[model samples]
Target: MNAPPRIAAPTHAPEAPRLRPDRAEAGALTRLALPIIMARIGLTLMLVADNMIVGHFGAGPLAAFALGLMLVQTSQMLGLGLLMGSAVEMAAAFGRDALDEVGRIWRRALAYALAIGFAGAALSQAAPTIFLALGQEAALAASAGEIAALFGWSLPPVLVYVASIGLLEATGRPYVGVALLIAANLVNLGLGLLLGHGGLGLPALGAFGVTLATLIARITLAGGALAYILLLMPGRQALGRPRWSDHRWADGRRQRRIGYAEGLSLGIESGAFASMTLFAGWAGALQLAAYTISINLNMLMFMVAVGIGGAAAVRVSQARGRGDPAAMARSAATALLLYTGVMLVVGIAFLALPGVFAGFYTGEADLLAVTTPVVAGIGFLSLIDGAQRVVANILRGYGDTWLPTASHLFAYVAVMVPAGYLLALGLALGAGGLILAIALASVLATGLLLARLVQLKNRRS
Candidate 1:
């Protein structure tokens, strides 16, 4: 019955008519983006430490760990997408200062995350057998099985960590979530180093030990974050004695419709990457190793872009809540620019010294040789990928999840996978062909998503 309160405009008056929209948007984006970029760099450093420790152990463990990470990341993308999509919804609700709705959204998301986590755990437990049945190489299948076993145990705690992160990001306290990640990763880095090798009186558990370290990190983060949210945040009372209620199937239905759409879209997108990995696997173990190296290096760049995209979602959602279409458009454009600039620099560096980046993963000459071109290709792709992700997030922030989901499905599943399979297998282009297909799909997806965002902005205008 009540209209939402207006967000007060900035108090500081400009002497001149306010700066151009591009300038203002850029300023706002920089303010939000810098912290996110720093956080991502820190997280990347932690992963680098983990990989450095693992790489020292031996190639087999490193390869196994890489495969495990790929499997977990692919499976978890659905849950991650669901959390993020719901977070955008909640961010919009929060920007309207709709506290009651925020609570309901959080509860619903936690329920969804839990269910998804359990299912992911179950699937991960069965992954080795599934891959084997898919006619993978015997050695690779056995290693994949071992990795899956580690992932099965790691799933529940990681899910809790991810769910907590969703709630934190939704409430517009991403800094807190970033802090938790920093602390957890620090612990993981130290423990991984000590236990991964036979250092500091700790018995080396090899890849499994590193997996255990990651599990510990996730549990620690989940526990710490829950405490911060419930006890320490400024508006703790909102969460403390707030209304809790029985499950509303209608709300669940609404969320699932949105969440599942986003989830499946992300799954298809990530599944394409996984399929590429399979294709690369067929080329040779060295090629698979190269694929793993190049991908890990690229993730550093991707993570930064994702953090900005997350902020874009939050900013756009908040703007949408206020019925400020212009501000939403400005925010989206600003985020795209910021992410593009950052990715461009990273991409250039990757292209210039692909081998240098791959060297971080292995000392093997053969693996490095195979990975160089893949890394170079991904560097160019990252620019386009970064732009598309921002555009997609902006749409999502405006509560338009389905369109982007459809776009991703069309681009990744329909185009990327089929193209890559034909090039890699039918035409025998090998790893290079797979990477080329990826580059093409990313460009297409980016262009389509950007066009859609422009059309939506025009309609709103």
Candidate 2:
């Protein structure tokens, strides 16, 4: 021992710990987010294309399409929120290694989405008279009615598409969902060109043709996603075989609870937006048309932020399932930071060239005059909205949905709508006042949501 002491004394230092992030989690978030972002971009492009063609045709067509979309989106928001909430639930189950439970949840969610979609479609088709009752101009009401009729036929397929995409994303195969959306969009674009403008010797069907193309694309994408889940990726640990028996009320009670809360929350928020548009309509047709154009562009940017927030939900839910609150908090923070950065860039770009962006949708001088202030308002509001969305997703990931529902009800219903009407109609600030109210409400909501997220995170800690 003494002879070997000199050699024995030599000790190697401990190896430095490698700083590999949780690769699976990181990869999962990136894979899920990128596809959603790309798909949203494609959707935005379609919107731009629609606006371009419709604007070139005339103000009436543009206004009709915009109003129709506003109504359709208000209905669709609830459905989409339900699907998204269900996806988070399934993803959490997958993280807990409960594969069968994920399938059970998915089946129930899909059933709900289908039923809701069909019912919505029927209502839109059967109740064109309802638009007349909303105090809209006679001409505007009739135009909206026609657009709603076309939307009715498209709702089921769109619902199916949304449900399938939720399932796929929950099962850690979001890329497949993205691919299907891309393919569908490509087909839609080609068909839209053929039917919308009568290219390729096809009949020009105008706005109705655009809706038809969307319906076909939705059906194709939904069918393809269903096939992939049943045949190609059936054996994944995250998605077991679909079980009809698991599609029971008892099995989906928790999911329904969360999904309904999420849906109602989003509906309240969207309804606030609808109210703003109504106020703009009261100002005049030109104001409505202009605000619609600017708001559509605003939503396109907002969707990018939303897609990122959705990815945060998946990542945070997975971490929570693994009992790692720290990782969950960090993931959410990262998502918020990323969203803020992106929104800053977008805000600056919009601020610098509001007219340029507005030009893509309309060339009407009167419309542009109203839209400029509205667009400027959005430039500031986007930052608040983008940040709040991320925080809201974090709360959702942790299964604290009811709080947000209450927050939206209070913020939007109790504050935003009344204030907007007073400012726009009562105070005669016109479209500018309407937009200002939106900005104010958004700021309030963002603050509330951020505070709630902090509290939730601290409690978990």
Candidate 3:
């Protein structure tokens, strides 16, 4: 019944030296981003593995898995984004050598994460209604709803892991999360096979079993991460113990505000994409299954940008804490530069071998046929999508919150949703049409966000 504590005033420190994208600074950014990139990819691979596993079972289960996952991921992104303020604040604190404040921020963030996670789990219980309201067939909705509710149980543990990882990442210990994620992935793969396919004297539970495996894996990740930080992490003493003073609601308003803007922005963007899946669903099960594979692949590639964006946020937040606008500019520029080169390579691969990539998800020729063009479309989409992603994080790093949310609203909701409806349904373009709408939205979103970042840097400079 106690209110959360208000934020303590910032402890000022002397401004650090200006940093350039010199070899050392760039090297530092690379070192931080690489593990994060691997970790993000590892997280995505778990979903990819689930799709691959379930896809072999038949298109019905795959479609249901996709439907459930799309819904769960929207909620997940909202929670993840809401919790982002933890990393932003902690990184700034670390930059100022305000070690105790970092601990306080983490504690507040963990509470926020748990609250959002539980809320999401509760909402997920209504999946059948949501899908039915969206106009899906009764049978598909029922199957997908079961999958959604089952997978929903993992949200709490997953967010706990996110809160812990955010603190670790902010404090320059990114590798710990990576190790935990790798272990979790291995466990998921093993359990997925055993439960999903009827090995080890158990009946095949299909999608339900696969989801149960994920739930267990997520709990393992949460527990392992908490254990390390609480008992075994270096400087555990400096992390400090939680106190009632740190729990007052009024004290944590600023952190919660950042989380609010981020959660809404991420929710809007993800919800728009989920709508596209619904549109594909209306086109029939074949188109829906194909769209799922294609979009999942796009997300896999997007993780690279997410990693760089995360690293950029930290570097820029650190620069901000040090009162170094020029360094912030350089860091933002460096992240954009790296993101561009990496996306170019990924785009080329997607375009050159779309079928090869599609083949990884399903061996069915009909599904592959429907999915290939969409995969190729994503190659173009990633270029634009990745830019917006990096710039949005750069804005977050600089403490500009609500504007990015507004931009996503305009671009993804205002632009992408109607375009998806028209292109995919109105024009009968099928799954490929859905992807084209995403590209169109990304083009607009990227332009708007890039302009905003430039405006901020110009004012600061």
Candidate 4:
């Protein structure tokens, strides 16, 4: 005998969605989007706080933190990008009343997360050598290596959080994930202040202290998210556990099929950004620290766009499964408009308060004097960068993955990397040159991805 359909709890009780998708185009998207946007911002803010704290420790500590992040974030993004398949797949399944498949997809995602996280941990050992080869100061690179190793150990928890959050979002439970992230941020803030400042009679851990905060927060997120998942899905809790009998290799392979394109896209984009970190290192430790601050501030705003994009992805996938082209277009359009509006406001803040934000990262007059302009540049760059990021995500929601991956390669590898290298080194353009290149890449990537979205919209219609 076959098992029963495994539909989990809907936003309401366990009932079919009344089949009313008319308003889901805009209203529903916004509803799903708010909590997700807040969650993304929350996570980014926590990291920004860490940067602010470490920046005050001194330029050297900030530089070490930047160098360490160069490796950890790139790898983490790659793994998380790959796991986005879980969201897309589960959303489709949930829409089509194949909720049991959502559980299968979740399990596969967890498996991939653990495997990828451990691999990244092992690979992080090479960060020091990579930084040195990229022309970083030997001392800064060595210190960064230690921090990177600690960050590597923290990835398993981070990946678990990613997996759990994706599952929750896919199942129309983003609020739970948001709540978990908020709780984790509170834990992180307390620990960050405590361990970071050596408040309890311990010596200051400097950059290492920031990393400790990250580890503790990540553990809190994973543990909390898992408990939530179990509470919401009591019957399938056994299947959610990682067991040979519960999950199959075939399911893992199926998920990876969709994920590889996203992974490539993220790797291309992140690799280009990481190279900018190297370019800053070439300038000196001070420049690297300043660059990190500017990038961190820019990314915090970018998270708003990412959250909107992720929400759009879920809505689009569901609309597609339900065979509703109009709803899909509406979701995409609404996401673009909302993300643009928020990012524009963020750009204005960056323009108006560049020095204020720079001061948040550091109070040092010397660092602030030089960092202000860089932070201002980030404000300018945030416009196109945020646009491209969300547009790419929107396309992914339409199940157009490979094109986005190819576009990123062209934008990052072909456009940004070469221009950044030539303008920064050959012409001595410094950080300005690199950011200008980033702007170009964002433009290229946005154009390509938007073209794909247009084509998809037309085809679907």
All candidates: TM-score: 0.87, 0.87, 0.91, 0.89
Clashes per candidate (backbone, < 3 Å) = 0, 0, 10, 0
Could you give candidate 2's per-residue lDDT for residues 91-171 as a string of tens digits? 778768788787777777778878888877877774357667777788887877787777766666677777777767666
RMSD of 4: 8.8
User: Which tens-of-lDDT digit does each residue in 148-234 have in candidate 4?
Assistant: 988887788888888888777766677787888888888888888788888778877777887898888988889888887877654
Measured by lDDT, the strongest candidate is: 3
Off by over 4 Å in 1: 1-21, 34-49, 96-101, 241-246, 318-326
Q: Return the TM-score for candidate 1, rounded to 2 decimals.
A: 0.87
Candidate 1, 340-434: lDDT as tens digits: 77778887898898877777777876666766777887778777766677778778877787887788888888888889888877897777777
Q: How far is 344's C-alpha from truth in model 3 (Å)? A: 1.1
Ranking by TM-score: 3, 4, 1, 2
lDDT of each: 0.72, 0.74, 0.86, 0.80
Between 1 and 4, whose TM-score is larger?
A: 4
The numbered model that scores best in TM-score is: 3
| Consecutive 10-residue window with the lowest summed lDDT within model 3 | 13-22
| 105 Cα displacement, candidate 2 (Å) | 3.2
lDDT of 3 by residue, 1-461 (tens): 99999998869854443323555556767877898899889888889999989988877889888998878899999998888777777876887888788888888988887888888888889999999999999988999999999898898999999999988887888899999999999999999989999977899999899999999999999999999999988887887889988888887777777778888988999999999989988988889898888888888888888888878987888889888888898898888888887888888999999999888888888888888888887877887887888889889888887888898999899999999999989999988888888888888988888888778887776
Residue 234, model 3: Cα distance from true site in angstroms: 1.9
